[model samples]
Target chain A: MSDILLEIKNLTVSVRNGKSDIPIVKGVNIEIQRGEIVGLVGESGCGKSMTARSVMGILPGPARKSGEILWHEPDGTVTDLTGLSEKALRDMCGLRIGMVFQEPMTSLNPMMRIGDQVAEVLRIHKLVRNREEAREKVIRLLKEVGIEEPALRYRSYPHELSGGMRQRVMIAMAMIGEPGLLIADEPTTALDVTIEAQILRLIRQMCVSRHMSALVITHNMGVVSALCDRVYVMYMGRIMERASTGQLFANPLHPYTRGLLSSLPRIGKNPEYLTTIPGNIPEAGREPVGCEFCLRCSDDERRCFFERPSEIETDEGHYVSCFMCQRV
Target chain B: MSEEILISARNITKSYSLGRKKRHIAVNDVSLELYKGETLALVGESGCGKSTLARLLMRLIKADSGRICFEGTDISALSGRALKPYRKRMQMIFQDPASSLDPRLRIRDIIAEPLRVWRVCPDKTEMERRILDLLDMVELKESMIDWYPRELSGGQKQRVGIARAIALDPELIICDESVSALDVSVQAQILNLLKRLKKELGLSCLFISHDLSVVNFIADRVCVMRGGVICETADTETLYAHPGHEYTRYLLSSIPAIGDDPVS
Candidate 1:
């Protein structure tokens, strides 16, 4: 029996722009085991968000999705979500798989009281029959997310709370569903470092305590280092490298991954010069020939410009898609 | 190592009235110095008043009680015409270049606006030449001078912001979370550019950021702030290696690093 909680296989997402269907997430593969936190890291235009959205069946209009998104349930039923009806996918989205976005200020309803928002999720899913029961659950959920005054805060509107508080409320809303897999897309990107650390800790604790798996999407390597067990480095919608967090950081194989690592401004002792990637990530659909990273890669070979490299397992579970790595 | 003090803030305190009776203290009795050709970083969490302190130093927002001196000249009381010259000498680069810049204007005009306001350029030709020079200094091609802010990448837009800030030859520049909005690669590019420009122009900088790691890379000295107060101040190396304050330690420990165990 496969222990995978969520598996994405040869997933391709494309958007129609004028005359052509441009692939944003091209032939990507990812797997999240039960109780594991996996990361999808990339710069802007790299389709990290697209991949997450595709999993939730929230792709924008004019976009097309193909391939399988296998979600395994506790009952041992393997559901190929790609072929599921819209109603079934919607049912699976919030109840089974929860999501948190980057901006909590906007993710939450500004008009609604915090209590109603949290309870609304439960009420919609028919998890709670009465208002009083939902209220108790909302306060309980708020307390679980580390809110100081859960009862007092339940009556408060979203605007009355701080950014960190708002994010916690969002987490409460997501967690009220008892989701097996939580997809947090840049959850802490907008938060301060201290608050981000707190949120990351909360997520880690919740994942452990609830036996929940997570697919965290972010560009911050520090976040990946702190939270993720496994990391996939995506470039131009394609995953260039995938390995355990320790292995990926210790010995990054792909040039793009190496560039990202070296480019991070460390906490102490600055390097003489940061090794920045030469160019920005290419726009989706207008990708370069061969490897998407070929244009910006420092060690690009002629073959890199002519042929796409397949994912090669360099070591046990450490995979890379680079012609140079393949050569070695 | 004794060097000339470029700018100094003494006992700066700022507060805002919440509703009718309550006053929320944004910055409380914070004091620091920016030395000639040195980058001083202010590190803190959001709502800790680091940005408010930056604004206070820039006189963008007035402090309740404080004395700010630029090269031994007390600029705390100066206003209007008296503040104009000081304003020219001290510039600021904001966090969001996209919003900081005028959306309707092209890149060249945006850069030249500061020069025009300061009367640094004599004519259109000189201003154009100076704008091209500034673009070159920022490592951007002159051909992009005609492009709008939306057309440029985040790094490029920041470069434009930098060019505008330096157009008047400011001695001191306050960078308020300048590179926080950029991607890592572009952030590195902007940082390198800033480092190079600081050296080349002998510029002193007051760098404010929530990201301690970025502060470590760019700042010579670090001031750790919390709840509107400066908890600790030390040289960057000393501060990072051995932070004295508990909050500083907390902040340091929170920074996620490769191979480091997660802070539980």
Candidate 2:
């Protein structure tokens, strides 16, 4: 039996701009197993967020999407969430599937008290029969996420809390319903190093203890190595490679993955030898005929310019979509 | 320890009254120094008063009780016109370059403002000459002289910031999270430029950042701060190789390296 909680296959997303339709997420595929952490690694404007947003059925308008987002229910039944209505989506979102957005400031309601805000989800979803039970559960959730003196913090507004504490609140809010899957999109990018480490550790710990799978979208490769067992490397709008953490770092089959690794700077190393990816991410509308990363690839092969290749499983539990990697 | 100190802070403390019985001790009794031609990194989480300490050194806010000696000058006590000359010798580059520079001013005028205000050069023509030189020194094209702050990239605007800070020829420059907003490649460029400027200008820098990897590249000495207190301080090599404090060890261990074990 497939252990996947979420499976996206050949997902294509296009947005209408001016006169023509543009494909931003050309063809992407990802799978998140139960209690598994999958790192979606890409640079800025590489459609990582789009993929995550699409999973939550929250992609903004002017964007057209196609393909299967098969979310296998806990009841052993499969559900197609792509065409769900807004109201239905809302009920499903905070209660069943929670998201920790990139910017917590935008994710949270600024004017409301954090306790009321956390309790709002329970009230909206009717998870609790009474206000007293909801209030108690909210405080418990806050304390569970490592917020100190949860009762005192319940009276504080989002603005009153520090950034690190606010993030903890966000985490607390996300875990109120104990959602089966959590999508953390650049959750620690805005945070300082120490606070970021704490958050990362917390998220990793909760994934196992809560029995919830997490989809972590970030550009930092080190975060992936630390937190993810499996990773999907996205370049432009497409997933160039997918592999277990060991196999991906040990043997990165895709050229884009290789370039990204070489470009990242390490601590206490010779700064003079730091390599850089030569070209910027391609414009959304104008994509390559073959490989999306062909222009930036160090060794652009002949087949890469003319033929688009599907993800080929060359190793067990590892896949790369590059034409060059397709050869024996 | 042999290198002559450029700046020193002895038992720096700062507190702000919150209008009640509570007084937030923003910066505790902290002591540190910057050495000539070396980068001394101040690493800490936010609310740890690292930025407040930077402001304290800049004299933006007076310390409650402490002594700041800048190159044999007890600048901590000096004020008004008495502190003017010391101000010219030291300058700061803020984190956000987009807002740091005035939106309305042209690039030439922005850089030349410091030169004119400090009277570093006599005539407008000489000022123009030096402004162009500063632009060149910061690796910015002279064609950008007519553009405003809004027209430049984050990196280019930051270059303009460097150009403005060095207009008066400061010996010590404080870069506060200068490249944290930038991508890694662009950050490397700025780091290289700063590293190179230190050599050519014989300047000392107090680099503040939350990223240990970036600090490790530039810092000769690293001081770890927590809850507005200096938890540990040592030479960069020693700090990384053998951390002394639990907080320091936690900070060091948090640095993510590729292929390393994810969890300990």
Give the candidate number with the greatest TM-score. 1
DockQ of the candidate models in sequence: 0.62, 0.34
The TM-scores of all predictions, comma-separated, are 0.96, 0.87
Model 2: docking quality category = acceptable
Tens-place lDDT per residue, model 1, A94-181, is 8889999999999899899989998988888899889999999989889999998899999999899888888898888889999999
Model 1, span B127-152: residue lDDT tens: 89999999999999989999999988
Candidate 2, chain A: TM-score against the reference:
0.97
Off by over 4 Å in 1: B260-264
Q: What TM-score does candidate 2 get on C-alpha atoms?
A: 0.87
Error in Å for residue A73 of model 1: 2.6
Per-candidate total of colliding backbone pairs: 0, 0
Stretches of model 2 off by over 4 angstroms after superposition: A12-24, A60-67, A74-76, A148-156, A253-256, A263-265, A268-273, A278-314, A321-328, B103-112, B119-152, B261-264
Candidate 2 interface RMSD to the true structure: 3.2
Best by DockQ: 1
List fnat, each candidate: 0.80, 0.41
Sorted into a CAPRI-style docking class, model 1 comes out as medium
